[model samples]
Target chain A: MKNTLWKALGILILVYVFAMTMLVPLGPGLLEFQDVNQVIESTREGRAVPEFQVIGFGTHWDQLPDSLQVFVQSKGQLAALEVIRVDDATHATVGLTLPYSLPAKSWNVLTNHPVDGTLLLENGLFLSDRFIDAKATWPAPSFIEHSSQLGLHFPYQPRIVETIRNLMLHVPLWFTMFLLMGIGFVASIKQLSNPRNQRDDDRAVASVQVGIWFGVLGLLTGSLWARFTWGAWWVDDPQLNGALVTVLVYSGYMVLRQAVDDERLRARLAAAYNLFAFVILVILLMVLPRFSESLHPGKGGNPGFNSYDLDSALRAVFYPAVIGWMLLGTWMYLVTLRMKRVNRQIELLP
Target chain B: MQGLAFLLGLESTAIAFAALLSVLSAISSRAGAGFGLTAVLGLPLIIPIVLISTRYGTDILNGILWIDTAHHLLFLGALTGGIGTLGFILFPYLWRD
Candidate 1:
């Protein structure tokens, strides 16, 4: 009863992860500006006003125009701008009045909609040279309060907007692969310590076999995501290369086992190789990728998704996904081990 | 010159070399050469895979275009093909013993 309950729990968590990751809408945010690089020139009539269109994603356009606020961040200070018009579901035009002596060459445009929260377009405008005394500081905009309740939603990330859902699938698969491989590593150690124990050898091989399946799934899902976001099915990324190498090395472990004919000798050789491969796996997947630059997150030069981008809402689903995948992987390994034992018994009967 | 070829075209070389080493190690184990010798011989052959992957991986991390990586991929493909042909011819001899 307990075993069935545990299996049911794993399946339920996975179903929850799948539904939530797919069903939840992306939070309201700015998609892009029609003209991100609008030039504002200095004029005799005070500040020069430049107008540009703003396109928002997942935003409700039914709100009043007065409620939509825009600001330009220049010289480390945010200056409030005037919204000239709000046109339809995704379009808006905002006017920015620049100071005569703006020290900053670039400015970021931020839109604060009353119902949609804050959306930012980084370095959205370039400021041209103007004639005014160099002020020590720029005026800061007053903090606008938003009262809209942004129900359950995934955080909006540029480039990986809709494809961000793949994170629930891809990352958890790798996590489960690592967990299963870790199990294999432990079993290999036990096998090596007690060379006579056949069960330890069975456990090691079973874990690795299932772990390889997860690794393959990870690679496939990662490739699909990369195809959508990075514009390639495969790129020369350190983390990606590392993952491929780790998988190949483990595959080599299985080949090595098949090559040896003697039962006792095969067990010993496989255990030793398993230990070595595990060390290499750690170095390839974890240590080396950190030192080098990679397009993948949590690696060199790239901020992890969990840093600021993975909001609490994502964490609610992501953590459960990892746990669910791990449980499922473990169950698969157990089934494989049982099958191996049964096969061995059948061979003995002859 | 051979070392440079192996270094620059590591992934393909490693794939071929790993297959060769696994076969050799398996044969050697049967002949009582033991796991130590198999590992010692295999380790050096696989190093190029690690070296080249990390070296080119840096460029990839900096977002190199696919066009720029064409040469690397080409060289890797050539090496793999050559080694695979060699392995096919030599495997029968290796397998008999």
Candidate 2:
């Protein structure tokens, strides 16, 4: 009864993850300000500044965002811009006039919408150094600023875009793999310490075989995520190589078990190999990737998605996904262990 | 000068691979599967040495001072020690039959 209860809970949480991962819309983001002037060199003679197009992701430009506020911010001051037209949900025509006695030559763009909240693009605008007309009237910043939005949203990442939702699906697979392998490692140590305990040997082999299944699933999901985001099915990367190597080593453990006919001899040999293979696992998965440059987040000085301001939104689904996947993996290992036990019992009977 | 620094990494790699190979060879001999068994078992254990040495060798080639690579050198030393220690402990059981 308890077994089925936990399995049901795992399924429930996974359902929640799937629903949230797909349904939650991404927060608005500034992609590029198209048709931007080469430089905002405002002249005293000609038209002040030309109109430019702004591109955004997940923006509601079509619904008449009367609260659409675009500004150039520098040195704790802002110059509000005029929105000339709205092309669609993703694009808007905006106009900005240079404010004299400006603090910096390059400034970022900040957009505030009633529905989409605030979006920013760093170094969105650049200006020449010659303009220093203190007497000139700067565009007064009179727009009423809106606070953070009320709706739930995942962060907008340029690399992964909408596919960032894969985080819930892809990462938990590897976490489950690690947990299963740890089980296998512990079972192997037990078999080595007491050779007469045949159950431990069966447990070790069963858990490891299940671990390999999880690891391969992790690789396939990871590869799909990579293809969608990194623009390649495979790339020369430290973390990827490490994961591949770890899986291959465990597969070799299986090969060794097959080649040896004697049960006692095979158990001892396979247990020994497990000890060595676990070291490789720690080295490749835990140690080496951190010391070198890796495209994977949280390694080699790259800040992970955890560092994002909107991380709480992701954490809401991500934590459950991890727990759910781990529960499911434990359930699989138990089933495999029982199958191994049945096989052993049948061998003895015959 | 770079060539000399790389030799140390290569040397550590050789010692690490040899330790892993000794155990693998015994298993292969017992299985009587020869190179097929050896290659599958050996590649995973040996690749870490290749991974670390390539990183170290590239550093030397790029003019990163030998002192700066203390971490990788330590990693290599630790890997060799680990494989050797495991071989020393497990070889007895493997050789008994």
Candidate 3:
């Protein structure tokens, strides 16, 4: 009864993770540039106001005109601009009057829509020193601000959008794999300490067998995610390579077991090899990857999932997925142990 | 101080891999003339680690991100750790017969 319940829980949690990962929508945010008018050098020097058009995605365009304000984000200050026209939903033209003391270089154009919040178009306008007088004192622009919306949606990361959902899948599989392997490591220690006990040897082999399955799943899912986000099925990433090496080393452990003929000798040699494999797994998966720059987050200088990636909404599903997968792996290990015991019983009957 | 550390790391990693290869060869030979076979098998496997460590060591000497080098140092720890644990656990088995 307990076994069936644990298995059911694993399946249920996976289904929930898959559904939530696919269903949640990305928050309303700036998508891309629609049309931007070039700021001419002579016109920039003159006193006339400069106008530009921008298109936005996931924005509440209907609350425009009165509630809309635009700003040129330059030199750490937000310079407010006048909204010349609202062309349509998702389109607007805003005008900015340059101060005599404006800083040279391109400034980001930010729109403050009451409903959509602040949307930014990076490097929207360029002010060359060739046009503006160098000695002119730049006018400080007033800050244009808007209240952020309250809703449940995925955070807008620059590169990863829908693929961010893979976090609940890819990350948790590796975590579960580690948990299973940790069990194997402990079992191997017990087998070595008391070489006479056959159960400890069985437990070590069973844990490893299940752990390898999880490791393979981790590699396959990671490869799929990498193909979409990193633009290749495989990149020369340290983390990915380390994971590959770990799988290979563990696979070698299975090969070693097959070559030995004597039962007790096979068990002892396998236990020792399993311990070696576990240590190498730690080195390859956890230690080696950290030193090299990798596309995978939480490695090198990149912020880990804990920082901004695993937001509250993600954490809600992510934690459960890990626990579910771990329980499932443990259950699989127990089944393998039972099979080994049954096989031994049959051999004794003969 | 950093250069000395890099040199120490490089030498230690090379020594460790060599030692691990020798141990692996010794174990494989129990089956047959397995030293040659094990060397042939293991050299290819360990080359990637050696190549990466060399490249990373150069990066360290050239004043790349110190944090990055520190992470690579962990890789060495892992290599030594696996080799060390395997040696301790498996040596008795090899000596039993």
Candidate 4:
């Protein structure tokens, strides 16, 4: 018992490590920043619109350096460029490109030259197109003329926020399900080979019950994800449809075992059905979703993580979560098996 | 099930009837009491995975378009198979008559 306890503790530590590595790093990978909503209220009515300060590490600023270089090449502004140092990074005031005559307020302190009457920020960071119209008179005709350059990337990166937490959901259910199904598979194979062993039959049935539980879980989790990712509670995508059918099929396997009264016949028939269903599960889950367009990973044409994506950080916790859950599940199965044996013994008492 | 549907194409209309028939066969075999007991005992096992699979599916998707529908389904199937199987194996006596 001491040795067993130590081994169990070791296994648990390994699992915790695994989950931490997989689930935690996902948060940083999908990191995104939000636009700082500065309150630019009109302090003094109309002498000048209050100048806004870009705050909260604005996301679209990365595009500015290239735009600045283009302006330099085009002779857009002869004004001397000055770099403002903020936290060891050089930030351009956009006012540097103006011809000294335009006040910082005129172009909203644009680091690039004013064109028409408006100023262009990095990657069309400026929300309005009228700014582009205003900056047309600036020397850089090439920069202000394009429409595509003006579109800013969307402000919020919800994918980063939502996807990192998914490790807890999608991966664990698969782990639990696989653990239960393996038992079912083992029990069925054992009973088929040894028909007289009621123990094997009991074990097989218990495995099926647990499997059905995981299957339902997989569906519920998938549905919740669908709402966020696909914006629907359910969709007819091949993957979604396939999973639904697979769960439904397995549920049938469970119900069949319960309805049959003859112990011998029930075991045999249920075992056969379990085998068939598992095979179909493999094909449905493994084979068919690959052939067409699917809104899921590991399918052709959909973007997914490559080998590099499963970095050391993710692998660390992920492997453990898998093992921990698998062990916990197995422990539960064994306890049930023991109880069943005891009950059977009690029933047999004369 | 596109697997069945893909194999049969539009012919799945025929298979659906058979699938329904199988469901009835299963229902008649299992006790309703057994089913309810399984549900009651299984809630804790089921709820967490339900929550986890969704969260992980999104994380795995992570703006990479390389993965398609089949992958998602397989991930889910593997998850269900793994966790549910573990539960069954771990708690066999729970189903004892």
**How many pairs of residues collide in each model?**
0, 0, 4, 89
* TM-score values for chain B across all models: 0.63, 0.86, 0.75, 0.34
Candidate 1 regions with alpha-carbon error over 4 angstroms: A36-48, A128-138, A145-148, B1-97
TM-score-best of 1 and 3: 3
Question: In candidate 3, residue A143 scores what lDDT?
Answer: 58
Docking tier of model 1: it is incorrect
Residue lDDT tens for model 1, A77-141: 77776666678867887666656666576778787777777778787776566553446356576
DockQ of each: 0.06, 0.58, 0.41, 0.06
lDDT of 3 by residue, A1-350 (tens): 97598788888988887788788776555555333555422233354555566666556666656787777775565577666678776777765566756545667878787777776767766666435443444455555577557466766555576677888878888998899889989988888778886888888889889989999999999999889878999998878887887887777777767766677777777777677677777766777666677888888787878756677877887888788788778888889999999998899994
Model 1 clashing-pair count: 0
Cα deviation in Å at residue B95, candidate 3? 2.7
TM-score of chain A for the candidates in order shown: 0.92, 0.88, 0.84, 0.61
Task: Score residue A179 of candidate 4 by CA lDDT.
Answer: 72
- In CAPRI terms, model 2 is classed as medium
> What lDDT score belongs to each candidate, Candidate 1 first?
0.74, 0.82, 0.73, 0.49
Say which candidate scores most in TM-score: 2
lDDT of 3 at B83: 79
Candidate 3: Cα lDDT at A222: 96
Q: Top model by lDDT, which number?
A: 2
Residue A342 of candidate 3: its Cα lDDT? 94
